[model samples]
Target chain A: MISDITLGQFFPGFSPIHKLDPRTKIILTTLFIIEVFLADTPLLLALMLLTTVIMIGVSRISFAVVLRGIKPIFFIIIFTAFFNIFMTKGQGEPLVHFKIITIYKEGIIRAVFMGLRVIILILGTSILLTYTTSPISLTDGLEILFKPLKKIGIPVHLFSMMMTIALRFIPTLIEETEKIMNAQKSRGADFSQGGLIKRVKALIPILVPLLVSSFKRAEELATAMEARCYRGDKNRTKLVKLTYKPLDFLWFAMAVLLFGGIIALRILPGHISPDSLIYDILFYKV
Target chain B: MKEIIKTKDLCFSYFEYSDNDNVNQAKIDVHALVDINLTVNEGEYLAILGHNGSGKSTLAKLLNLILTPQRGNIFIDGQDITKPDLTEDELFDVRRKVGMVFQNPDNQLVATIVEEDVAFGPENLGLPREEIRRRVNFALNTVGMSEYSGHAPHKLSGGQKQRVAIAGVLAMKPKVIIFDESTAMLDPRGRKEVVDIMEKLNREESITIINITHYMEEAARADRVIVINDGKLIMDGTAKEVFSHVDELHSIGLESPQGRELINELNKAGLNIDTDALNEDECTEAILNKLKAI
Candidate 1:
């Protein structure tokens, strides 16, 4: 029952990228996202895609797993593509000869490009961020990054403390829900066979007990914390201090170069014609 | 002797609601614990004996400051628990010193991974990562759960989960670990597993243990047995002294161990036997010796 949901969700590895500091990973991911946003042309977007593919290769995770991560966003991709293709009005030559629905070269180009960009963005970030770093280390990185927020009286320490607890409890609560479901099922509460309203009514049995247990758990956790002399912001020290290494510097350099290349391409005074052979073959056909 | 915990005129009243939703209207205060005075000597292994609703759990909660006395004072390491001067932090400090392990091992465990759950208390203390690691290892080793450190708590048997829960409390480095019928939910094998860990912790680590249980056999293993009936401290003494008063125990809706009953039957059936046979092995040996004598 407790094993159903995945939390932390990290694939353990000894790879160089996986071994990098979580703060470094977080920074590099942000850098990659900036580069993705700056990517306006096919060439620059291909570079971003190449980096993500290389990341997936280096992490040694199966391609199927990476693709599985994209499954949830498939609908969003389709929705945006459909909306952009049909709704975008362009003054350029109409490509499709249909009644009241004219597909322009510009609209078709805009839709495919927008769809590809969103898909790539989601895939790249998922591989770099959530699928790799453990939640504990992620929180460690966040706490360190937001340490400066303490100066502005933001209580960054408490913020991280809350994050750690929340992350720690997600799996716990999921496990509890599974247990409660099983217990209710044991008592002959059939959750599967019902209409929408009946199904929701059946869920009340699960939800109420889950809520009660979670609160009880929170109370117990608080008591346990108190027993350990835990105060939110006090004399606390971390065992692992996030240290940026030479590899991190190399990553930063690569990111800057990528961003520089994108800007160089975008700012240049040359606009390629809509009939660029590669753009049509790669995106328009789909 | 340093009195680790003391309560005077302690009483607890839980409400019985006719309707679960209407807490305000149909609430009747059902007295859980009555006026009681008890002292826990430092480093003592005390087992509390009572049937359900006999106030054993109420007493355990009161000692840990999880449930403050409604009509009395509770002292932990000599500090009054309900003092106005005691901040929430101080109360936490008191709780840390006195950790509690509840009945359901599943409910008590809050983390998916065993090691992470064990480290929860130390992490809450905001200890250095190294220190928390050290405590987790120490606690796991104390409960003989070091080998299962990486295992999932849910994958564990009922007994193993209870051990994990104990390890979690142990990581807090609490001076007094209270088991509030912690083993009641487990099978016999699981109960023995938890009791063995408790035995080792009390014997070797000098961690005081207060086990509240309905099982009189468990009380047989404690250094002292305290019987609570309807919230009153009816009896307090060594295992033999308490268990010998079988009639008194039976009067309070409790029973001596099953082996005790077997011995009484054997003795009544024209066999010379010891009624003080507190454990199965001892009772078995006594019966075999009597058989040889005949």
Candidate 2:
């Protein structure tokens, strides 16, 4: 049951999106996330959705897999949408009148918009960043991106090294956890047949051994790393260097175009606005 | 042969606190390694055999500079690494020269991918990108893991993971590689695979090998075997010389290889058979020859 998590899962592929440099994918993912927030009108959100769909298609990741990525956060998404629906104040009559709650037209629109925004946010980042780029490359890109922070004495390399090590050990630790759980089960420890507090108490047996083993592993790993001459990014070199290809530049150009379109939709005059006409006709019937 | 690693009366102790809550508890010094003098020549296959907590691992750590000696000096390639004023760069250089493969394959790897972990040591050395690439490829190929380069480390078997760990050390191009009970967690097949690599590295690549293990068969395969008992070097000799003393090995909580044990058993049964055979093949041949003579 603990192994169902698909977070940070990379899908190996030979698509154009996968071929782009990890740094490019990371930057573009950030831009797309910002664009998701900047998208105010239905037309703009539709454009964002179109971009996300195109990306997922290009990466050859099935829609089913992308939907599964959203499954773990499905409850949070529903809570957010419902909270916005009930609590948001609008400039119109109530769409639904309950005894203690009133739902407005704007609130419904806002909730739908927010939900779509979050869905697109998850899909866009997962497709461009996590799905296409391997975890090592992703961390490598992050380390390079945050290199300038080293001047502020932030220990960027240490953090990335920690991240890489954590990623490397996640599977190992999970396997260890499973082994401990099975061992406890064989000793007649019941994990499933308990109340909330009892269940949490039951976990102590598993957690204690897991923690002890983790500390042991950490000490051994430190010695092993020391034996390998690892000294925390002091004059360290990379075997797989991150370099920009022509495809990256092309991706950058496309991102710039998207940014410009978002800006134009936000600041352009009402009559000349491409999204405004659609917004007016869709929401208020000009 | 030129000595690549030499330790002069090296000593190390771990201070165990009596009680964490007590402010004035007396700390007990657990001597992990006590005065020992040893020399590892270039391209030598030296096996350290000991029972658990016998200071063999402590000796391995001291050689790799993971643990600083409390009282003695370690000279690697004619340079003293235990100097009090040794710079960090100098320490790293010495560490790079002395690579170590640890017991657990799961803990040692720093990268998610096999190739990246192999590249880790070279990357730490700050080698050129091309040089790192070349070394990583060469290391993987040398370990026969070239195809599994792109594979995730945790998905690999224990033997494969240990090989990748060796490849990780090999990429650094160290003069000496120490296996600190590296095959302890592996199955017999995995143990054979790692021991074979140690032999190959010592024989073909001319890299000095210091394998710390409790396995008698593994010790028999090494050119020289040193037995550590209770933080002291109890026995150091050629494999044949060491394994022939079956009673001494048994007294120190170690067993001679099956071959030696069988010969001893045959000798006890009133058969005059040579007890010098250190491995099964030699023991079997010696028995056959004795039987034919009879």
Local distance difference test, per candidate?
Answer: 0.80, 0.89
Report the CA-based lDDT of candidate 1 relative to the real structure: 0.80
Candidate 2 has what TM-score? 0.92
lDDT tens per residue, model 2, A1-286: 6765654788888999999998898889889989998887787898999999999899998999888999987888899999999998887689888899999988888888889989999989999998889787788899999999999989999999999999888888898999999999999999998689999999999999999999999998998888898888888888887889999999999999999988887775454544665556433410
lDDT of 1 by residue, B1-294 (tens): 899988777788888777667646787788888888888988899999988778788788777677777788788889888676778767777878898888877666655578878877777677789888899899899888999988867678889989998998998889899998988899999999999988898989888999888887898989899998887899999988888887788788888878877877777787868557788888788888888978
Candidate 1: misplaced stretches above 4 Å? A1-10, A88-92, A147-209, A228-230, A237-241, A268-286, B11-30, B79-83, B87-90, B110-113, B124-130, B268-272
* Model 2: residues with Cα > 4 Å off, grouped in runs: A1-4, A72-107, A270-279, A282-286, B17-25
| lDDT of each residue in A67-167, candidate 1, tens digit only | 88878889998898888877877785788869978777777877888887887887777777778887777887988898898888899877777787776
Identify the CAPRI category of the predicted complex in candidate 1: acceptable
Winning candidate number (lDDT): 2
Residue range with the least summed lDDT across 10 consecutive positions in model 1 chain A: A277-286
Compute the DockQ of candidate 2: 0.85
